[model samples]
Target: MNMAVIGMIAGMALAFAGYFGGFGAFLLVAALGAVGFVVGRFLEGDLDIGDIFRARDDRRR
Candidate 1:
């Protein structure tokens, strides 16, 4: 499915979850979804482990 369709479906699911399961369940689902996205990106070679925690560098004189 296209991104828009997928997004609509996900939005509906989240709304149902929030309505039926309340705020905690909504946050749980969101967190799990974020984890899944990260893992999928890693598997797709679009993300690296260090990318999550790596700090930026800056030099000043």
Candidate 2:
């Protein structure tokens, strides 16, 4: 629950920064969010998100 809240705040920060023309802040938060998300998945023993999401072109019998 705490992580969820923090994630929400980070997302808001990214958006808020973008609105105020703080591109660096926006990118920083986005990078943090991306890294944190990927790390969380790693801790959970999940593979890359791209691997989790199968492409339509790769769908075959």
Candidate 3:
């Protein structure tokens, strides 16, 4: 669905995890959510694996 609804659902999930499962569970949910998001993007071809691993130029002054 839309981003707003997705965001709301994710928020609710985190809230439930925090309330019923504690901080560790909250963190676990958050981390898994992030991984899922990335995987989804990758699967959708919206993200390139090389983009994530490409090194940045840190020598720019």
Candidate 4:
């Protein structure tokens, strides 16, 4: 799916959490979504662990 669809789904999820589960659930879902996104990117090889840890000046040119 495209970014728009993904965003819509995420919004819907947050809305549901906020409506039924309250603020804490909304935050939990949002945080988990972010972690899921990062894990997905890492598994897809689109994210490099070292890139996140390395100093800015140490990055490849």
Candidate number achieving the greatest lDDT relative to the actual structure: 4
For model 3, residues 1-61, the per-residue Cα lDDT tens digits are 9999999999999999999999999999999999999999999999999778866763232
Off by over 4 Å in 4: none
Q: What is the C-alpha lDDT of each candidate?
A: 0.82, 0.80, 0.95, 0.96
Best first by TM-score, ranked: 3, 4, 1, 2
Clashing pairs in 2: none
User: Which structure is stronger by TM-score: 1 or 3?
Assistant: 3
- Writing each residue's lDDT as its tens digit, candidate 1 over 1-61 gives 7989977877887888899999998988888877987898999999988777766652221
lDDT of 2 at 53: 81
TM-score of each: 0.79, 0.52, 0.92, 0.89
Give the number of the best model, judged by TM-score: 3
Arrange candidates by lDDT, descending: 4, 3, 1, 2
Q: How good is model 2 by TM-score?
A: 0.52
Model 2 lowest lDDT segment of ten: 52-61
Query: Residue 22 of candidate 1: its Cα lDDT?
Result: 100
lDDT at 23, model 3: 100
Q: Model 1: residues >4 Å from true position, as ranges?
A: 58-61
What's the C-alpha lDDT at position 30 in model 2? 86
Each candidate: RMSD: 3.4, 4.1, 2.9, 1.2
**Ten residues in sequence with the least summed lDDT for candidate 4:** 52-61
